[model samples]
Target: MRERDIVGREGRFIAEGKVVLNVLLANPAFALESLLVLENRLAGLTGQIKLCPADVPVYCVARDVMDTIAGFPMHRGILAVGRRNDRRSSEELILAMPDKALAVVLCGISNHDNMGSIFRNAAAFEADAVLIDETSCDPLYRKAIRVSVGAALKVPFAREGSIEAIVTRLQSAGFEMFALTPSGMTSIHDAKPARRTALLLGTEGEGLPKSLLENLQTFKIPMSANFDSLNVATASGIALSRFSRFSGF
Candidate 1:
């Protein structure tokens, strides 16, 4: 199971923590294969276990045994394997949203922690969906799911496309794309919301590519001159919050 830390199992991800496990068991969109719980945790999770599909097995193991099997300390004492049911394309997902939509678009966000926190922010701000480029890390990666506090599972997301193409599609679908960068021309607060808006974010150090930045309207969070930049996740939270308020997210 620890191997999942490196490469997740095909079409499946490991969910940790009582909260994440509860999300896995609660969402019909995900199908649980099995649950491994510490013997001590089993009694507390009995209600959740009964809600699992009859075919799905719940294994109870001693704390030491669970730790040994997990190849780590396994402090949460709760892990579950699950697969997603709704794997929609980016175009389909975008098309399904309301005319006025708020979306978070990511480019070159390879850090799993950043990816997770972005998802959490997107969920917190009630983004209609998150669109990640082919270069971004998998939002469903185990550590990402864990770091997101299960928001990775809650937010709708799609990946695998050129950043340019993704931007074009969003424009074609009536979304006004705003590239968020430190050097952006307009302050995020001053930018008016469109019928549908896509907030494009990039890795903190590099920011968005110049070509993409030139192609779309750009906005930035107004900050003191002392700091060069905000963490990509933190920037996303601020931008999404502003956009969500305007878009009625």
Candidate 2:
């Protein structure tokens, strides 16, 4: 396949899990930066956009059909195949996090905007990496990136496939998993944010699935008596703000 048009190199695609695979890269810069950020293999590479792998100039000829194929606009201009990060045991992520860190866990959230807003809030509230359940929308998706102004790129993340696995992992690592529910048992105002806590927020439409609901320590964002629930992203901002200042580390 002929390399795609010469969309000028936009630096690199720097993220974890989404790299590391021996992906048939159409653009070498995006592929290389994606893997090098892992620190596992960070040697013998200049951090510039020079085409060192001279045999394969960074080119992908799919731009003409990309929009029709992906069902969305291609903002990043380049595409590649990369494996999603392995579901890290919740404990592994928790232990790696700082003491009393405020982290947001995206559970069953599909709207790219909602996903981006969650991360933007996490960064705004000084929260640590945003944790996403295995079923959540990718924060690195193109629209998500645009919506987040690349804040999704700025924050760190640990992705998990199962709600139970993440809860068990976080619990084992000494982090509380507060499941946000409209009909939850405790209100956010009365709830205390732990120095090390993970908020498990559900999607806006269906709320938490019964399986996840049964597993989480639920919390409600107290609202005007008549208001049923806040939009998932907005509620996250409010909840995150409560914990932001005390995280003074």
Candidate 3:
């Protein structure tokens, strides 16, 4: 299928590769609309194909045909169409969180790679959910899903409202909001997270809005004097790892 055929399908997305296809099939949060495989690679995918529901259709095509259809070489030789089973609002997602929770909140994160990596880290740290503002790119974007190694399919997230509004809602829900930045007042190692904690991150370069840092409790990862900041994704991993239940903090 062409790029236009897969993207902007309205609640639908294209997932590629065996790993991502497996994630799509296994997760009940997303429904598989259809699967496409390279004919030569079909034998190796029997186990995954069996995992699909009886109603889901699977199509196998020759390599040349597949390449022509995709408008590029199908190196991984796997692709599937998936749709979110439920699109929850930010309020609904927040209300559903357990009392003691760790969440990653993002603002204006337009880079797909960074978005994907953040989700992967969130999953690794066992975060409860990810809250993103409207300006951020879709976590379900094809490259984001692939870069996340399917973690995007596993993490629960909702995109809505302005960054300030999102932070306010989480704050009202008993979350201790921390705007992560280079000039934070408290060191990440020293700050004690509350029962419900949210780590706020912003796009690279500009970082979190100055107004947010002024209002919320802020924390920073200590670094060498020569370096001032970490990439948004890297910073998230460090912060989430510190606050995650597994950290024994």
Candidate 4:
């Protein structure tokens, strides 16, 4: 199938590379529909293939055939169709978190790289889950999953509703929400995060909406005076790292 076709499939997404395949095989949140591997790469993937449920199909194809099917040179030589099995709503996901929890919330995050990087950081720092707004790109998008090095597959996430509604629900659930913005009132170091915390991030150029920023307790990363901003993904890593450290997660 073409890249777009794979990404556009309902409920299913393409998981590429052996590392991602390994995650897909192990993660109970996703179900493996099938696998497509380069014929020569099959032997190397025996362990991963063995992890697949007996009912899941595995296809081995020639390099040229795989390349033509993918609409590009298939360097990774491993691909799987994975369906999201645990599709929780934002409220359901939040309600499931432990009393002491840390979450990353996204608003209008349209870039796949940023989405993937944020999920990767979330996984690295042991964030309980990621809650995405309606405007954000799907974390399960093929390129995003690839960029995350399979963290997107492993991390628990839910995408639903508007940012305002999601924020309101988080507040109702006793979560202290912190919006990360360049003009944030409190430096991240000075802010006191609660036992249950949710870090809110926005689209790269616009950042969080001014109205949203005004209501939430906001935090900013201390940076060199010359630069006012960081890439959303980099900013997430920095913010999550700091928060995770303080929260002792």
Candidate 5:
């Protein structure tokens, strides 16, 4: 696809909709397919793109410029901003799932790469859902979806507010809430999740907030001496592997 189909083209041409600055940068292949959702005609694009088959929002910018407004840059190129994706509700997501299924509950994680990795790991492990707290980065944001290698586009996800409410709902639905932290005495190997589990991973720098820590079940990934912790993405990958069991034990 041409660059205009990816992000906005130039002046006089608006973005397809209210897409964030980054997601457009993430997936350059997103474009009008049917009604709402976007379709990727080109393969091997970084993931950061999404669309619905029902939304009718559209606009046109006449041309593309290698550098239009900011006359100078490290690289010159045209850009297109995609439409904003609709966020699903937690109830809708739960109802959409089968019983005793697994989903990833991303806590206050902020880094785009970590968000992307979490989605990739979710897809890799066959988790049922990927839920993000209100404060977390938008997984649909171009870089995240791109970094997630389009796993963000493939996985069923919901962006919600109030981590407490979402967690409570998950708990009520019988999800085992395991908070991934370095401080926990029980390692992931010992904690061992079941068929129905909610892996709650925290942020990049400060880790889980004290408020969330107070309520959820917490644990750490046991590492070699002197090594404090792994990058949030790496740790999630390692933790995800442990969920692998003998003949689906």
Candidate 6:
């Protein structure tokens, strides 16, 4: 467990806290490997713990031992190791989404918190899927999952090779890609939603690369003076909210 603490063990990820543990237990997409909880927490989590397959082990340990194993103060008193069972390639993910879909495409978003929040927003707005480029952080990173409030577990996502590859696949799949940037040719409010829509976002400082921006339809959230743009995650929330409302979730 301690070894997994530093770097997620192989393909395994640590699901921490009561809420994240619950999501891991309830979601079949994640295959349970093992569970460790402070003895006091065992009572509260017993019901859910029992739902795990008989083969999956659940251990109750002293708080100090748990903390030592985690290499930190284990305030949440809960931890579980799980692996994703239904991994899909980017092409497959795009092909599987609904004919009328709304998705978020991320490019070069390195911050884990922003990635987590983006997933949370995607789930909140009932987005069909999230497509992240190679430059983005892993949504399954321990901190990212916790920041997402378990929304990362609930939402389906695929990490593709590059922004260009992602755009190509989405375009081939009949998606109308709208790149979100400050120098957009159109305003997000005036842009019409399509049967298959993708809202593309980039990193905070540089935004989307010129190559991508030049090729795709670009739109921006109109803002007042003094501020040129919003944070990537904030902009994503605003855009997702607008798109979901326009397209009926």
243 in model 5: Cα distance from truth in Å? 2.0
Model 5: per-residue Cα lDDT over 99-159, one tens digit each: 7677788877888778988888887877778888888877765457657766765677887
Worst 10 residues of 4 by lDDT: 1-10
Total backbone collisions for each predicted model: 0, 9, 0, 0, 23, 0
- TM-score result, candidate 2: 0.65
Q: Per-residue lDDT for 115 in model 5?
A: 90
Please list all clashing residue pairs in model 2, or write none if there are none: 4-59, 4-60, 4-61, 91-169, 100-195, 100-196, 101-195, 134-160, 134-161
Candidate 2, residues 1-249, lDDT tens digits: the string is 111221112322322222212221333323333222212222322332243245433333354565454445554444432223333455556677887577777778999899878877886777776777878876666456556654665566766667677777677777887888888899877787775778878889888788778867788887777756688999888778765765442
Which ten residues in a row are the worst by lDDT in model 3? 1-10
What are the root-mean-square deviations of the candidates from the true structure over C-alphas? Answer: 1.8, 8.9, 1.3, 1.4, 7.9, 1.8
lDDT of 3 at 47: 97
For candidate 5, what is the total of clashing residue pairs?
Answer: 23
The local distance difference test score of model 4 is 0.89
Minimum summed lDDT over a 10-residue window in model 5 is located at 35-44
Model 4 per-residue lDDT at 1: 62
Q: Scored by CA lDDT, what does every candidate get? A: 0.85, 0.61, 0.89, 0.89, 0.62, 0.87
Task: Give the alpha carbon lDDT tens digit for every residue of 83-156 in model 1.
Answer: 88768889988998887789889999999999999988998888989998999999888889998888888888
Kindly list the per-residue Cα lDDT of model 4 for residues 4-38, writing each as its tens digit. Answer: 66654667899889988888878888899999999
For residues 47-98, write the lDDT of model 3, one tens digit per residue.
9988888999999999998899778998999988899886898889999999
Worst 10 residues of 6 by lDDT: 1-10
Give candidate 4's error at residue 19 in angstroms. 0.6
